[model samples]
Target: MSFALKYRPSNFKDLLGQEVLVRVLHNAFNLKKIPESILLTGTSGVGKTTAARIISMCLNCTFGPTSDPCNTCQNCTSIKNFNHPDVIEIDAASNTSIEDVKVILENSRYMPISSKFKVYIIDEVHMLSNSAFNALLKVLEEPAPYVKFILATTEVKKIPVTIISRCQRFDFRRIPTDKLVNHLKVIAKKENVSFDEESIKLIAYNADGSIRNALSLLEQAAIYSNKTLSEKITKEMLGYVSRYTLLEIIEPLVIGNTVEAINKFEEACNSYNPIIILDNMLQIIYEICYFSITKKDPSIFNDNIITHVKNEKILSPTFLSRIWQVLFKGIQEVKSSSCIKQTANMLIIRLCYLSSLPSPKQIIDKIQGNTKTDNNRKALLELLKSNNMQDLYNQIYESDLEVTNYNNGTLNIKTNQVLPKDFHRNLLNFFYNLTNKTWNISIDQNFDISKSSNSCYNKSLDPTVCNILQEFDGAKVINIENIKKEQ
Candidate 1:
């Protein structure tokens, strides 16, 4: 019993985070502007109940608001034990009917039996139904001078605006990582518990903005490991997959290995939660982006992982963002899927194929370097006549589409930029034979270039291929003309 409640923060000064709220509340009390009712809104375990108790102690104590309560006084002792005659802690969830509320109200009119003010705390007040809320609204709207109401709720949305408006609301934010870690360290020392900083951070991350949740997870982890906390122990306790496995999954997607990537994902299915896998990928991408943009180590995030885990920071921000887009879509797909593994595998395949894609710069640069000149055009015309489809595909894929006119056994090639010799040969062969004409490839900044033949070509190659060729060349297609005079 002592262990369960031992670490509860005893006063506002003891509370970590929420400095503004604490300071405001203190000022309100000091100035005697304490409202007749107050709403404490936030997620559970961040000291709402404890704060309520502390306030009760402060208001009724013989010597008060000096950082320490006179716990020996009758009012302080009763409130401490939560059995004060003047202070009532009601579980609004369990007794939410109009009759229960009416009974409390009847008692409210009479005033405090012993303390300065009659205080009523309704926990999970949002759980009260509409009828119950209506019944309680009368007392909430207008209260006696000596009566005070305190309402706490996790789901503030469920509480009607009418109820919210009547109370002075204070929102408790999630405790920060450093604050929580230090608090945990202090508690552990007093309790003779053993743990490391990394293990504590893992617990904090799992808590997800709830200090109470953090403490609860710490208690559970500590018990499992006999008060000794380590990364391995915490991972096992929480059923979390290691960073290495996540990196392995990312490696295949980055390098364009669809089969191997999907296989690795299958191998880790039992060991990993798909949602968590997606979350890890997001964290990894953020780390990479941070490293790329800021030249900082992603490992020092200080919230989750501690030591720099890997050097996957080599990935660029744009690439990381693209990968994240694929992953974000994949996670959404897997969530509604009846067969999660199959959906995840399909998504992994899609992710791998993304790496094979060329950026706009690459395509534009290739086209610039591989324009067909007089010598190149003649060489390419020879390849065209010889009928080399493979060479044709390679050259077309590699080059920008500038050569617009192909007619009657001669290749007219045009470009303001020079073309690659190999590219010239490949395109010359493919176009001349396919059109039954010598290819005419021309280059001129003034001439409107033809639409990307490779882009149009790839539409037939990969189903997911989307041609964004216009972005690279800073030009648009005027026309595509292929003419063969009667041969």
Candidate 2:
């Protein structure tokens, strides 16, 4: 199979994304307005190297600046083969010291050996240290007429503003999924490979907008399927779980079913790898929030689940937003934790508890429904008015009881999820005594001590585990014996 680099487009016409940049470069080259120093900023595998080569070819083409590189010419062929004496490619990552910069500078004063203009292409320019940048500044500021410099880096911010001000900067964005997928389709067809639409989509999405990555993944999928391609093969090759599994785990969280939530998580963990499971869950939550706000079918979320989420209001723009806040923090936690499964399970349980907790809107609705006096409700009203709902929710979620929605009909309240039932009753009664009327009260579900069952907690069953599983009251492993009969 042709890997990404093997089918690498050599000309600007073959470039997938960054049309504006290409147009600008093409116009510049046509106008004979090539800059002495050019800076290309973008992520890796997004054709930075390819673009640099094309620019070099354009400048050195025997047909002239306004003409295309006639691939037949010695200059064009040598540049394409990366053996042109005038076209120098350096890895700044390995040669990042100031001495290396001086060596490059020592040669910058000389004219091209055989081509029209000598080109210096420095990949990963950000790897150059401060001294290295300073060493190269003078030569860049006043370059020889026969010299061209193309600096490419994934990070542009690290390059000193001094160096930045001296170059024509081209910001290459990540290749969009659609464009990448289209390119992938062309490659697949050319390679005599067959793949489903979903397979292409997954590869494109997983590539994260890098053409090189998309090609690499396609290659991996092809190998996994024994030189064939399909949606199932690609998914299995990547070990990526279905969106359904993420949705199933999330449903229990929406309804505050701790046991079922953990159980569903454990069941998914069995077949799918733990990291993949967490990533899929995190992605779904992100999509749920994004789609909820944009109100568009992105084709990633299942249609039926979207319908259900739309109907139940569980996935409201606001609620989904809050869920995202919780999940984002949880994702980081799971990623950093030594025990992946245990950390992820804890995150799931925490999400379920958070879902059961009163939403910001619920708090506002309760405050509005209770207190009669406008002046008394103003304090709680102001709290809601501020968009600091996340902060308040967390404060209320973690604090102790004695929270009163109204004291002497004044809406002064505190909240806690861990308050004892009797203490909670007394706290509510205290508020009622002050108001001389019933006040709305609520208590969220506590973290279930009896329901704790994470793989990390039960490490006797596995040796590679790091954390202790949540200690459940009565949990057992049932290993079924094989039935051997005379057969």
Candidate 3:
């Protein structure tokens, strides 16, 4: 027998990490009011099926309906061995047709042959066909006093609501990591296996809150290390990156050293998968964000985590935010790329490049201090001319437009002309291309062009020619001599 089955809980006292279910079941047994039907739902390996089997044993025990079954009794031993005369175990996943359910329903009508109750245990009950469920519903709704039903499923949502409403439901929760580690410790002592504390913790963490999975990993780790588990063997077996190595990889990135970061990554690549490295980096980034906000390190992490926190204190929140975004985007890239090593290298280089760039606030401060804003209109014209936007420059220059303000990469203008629909979009694109930064161009309609000294209509010129020029900013009156000759 495997560690999971060999160590399965026999009574309510032995069940771990499911206090509420244990309490409810114990109370039901005490009152002799156990429900006719039950539904246990949870993720696999969290003890849903185990709980169901325990319930079956309790209901059919020869010592009466007790939460603590006497394992020595015939009924208890038979149920445990899955060879009881009255207790039936069904894998609903395989027997999903109506005919399969009919056989159980037909037998449920009879009295128990030797046990106190004729129990039926269905695993993965959600896999049953609709017709099969309908056939079983009649028997479940009104079962004989001697019959009991226990159903277990990983996906409760897939089960029909009608069947759910008819049964007493219990939701099984994931085992906590601390509880899992302690459980592994007890098992190690019993199995006479010596393991380091770090190895046990690593096994528990890798289990992802499943007790069965923890034991499975424990079994594998024990075999890998020849019954003496160490953190080094555990890391190599699981392809996990240690906290120290993760810190080393991130240090080069934080310092903006691309070559060193790539070299470190390549060195670690031999021992760990790239995805695992990125996952560890992501966790560190999260811890950094947490430390930056609350000024405290996460308790779950090691003391070396504090070293990272102290080193990253000099980083601005904005800089940390960019790092998180780039790393997050790279995760997806690495996962989908055919060549993981090349993809990981590119991701690291990208982070290094981004680390060297200035934050938004720093860029704003630099622009405010050094940007030439005294001649705002001339600056706008020069920017336009340098970008080969002469047509747009001439259009704006000849029109009744005034440069109200130009500062910190934003250009504010007051214009009377009805600009083209695409003017704003085109201008934004031009600014983005010229500065390699986004520039805001805002138009203020309230600024009266009539009051401007450069207003074309204000000049003492022919009224018709002025109106024509003002309306068409780029129009030229090359010759005024011949309206009649032109006609």
Which numbered prediction scores highest in TM-score against the true structure? Answer: 2
Per residue, candidate 2 scores C-alpha lDDT tens digits across 279-323 of 777777776666667877665423444654532556777777777
After TM-score superposition, the amount by which residue 394's alpha carbon in candidate 3 deviates from its true location, in angstroms, is: 18
lDDT of 1 at 354: 84
Taking the tens digit of each residue's C-alpha lDDT, what string does model 3 give over 372-453?
Answer: 4436777778878877897678756666666767877888877655455566787888878877899878987553433433
Off by over 4 Å in 1: 2-4, 64-68, 95-100, 298-314, 322-343, 346-487
lDDT of 1 by residue, 1-487 (tens): 4433766666678777878768987787778787788899888877788877777777777675434566788888788777899889999889988888888889999968887888888999999888888878889888998888889889999999998999989898887777777777777777678887788888877777677788788888889999888877988898877766777777777888788778877778877777777677677767766777886765533533323344353266777788888788788988989988778778888888888887667888767655533345545545544665654544443443343443465545444322344555655566655777665654343332243343333232222232444344654433444566997
Error of 1 at 81 (Å): 2.4
RMSD of each: 12.8, 16.7, 11.8
Clashing pairs in 2: 403-414, 404-413, 456-468, 456-469, 457-468, 457-469
lDDT of each: 0.72, 0.76, 0.82
Candidate 1 lDDT trough over 10 residues, lowest sum: 457-466
List the candidate 2 regions with Cα displacement exceeding 4 Å. 300-304, 308-313, 360-487
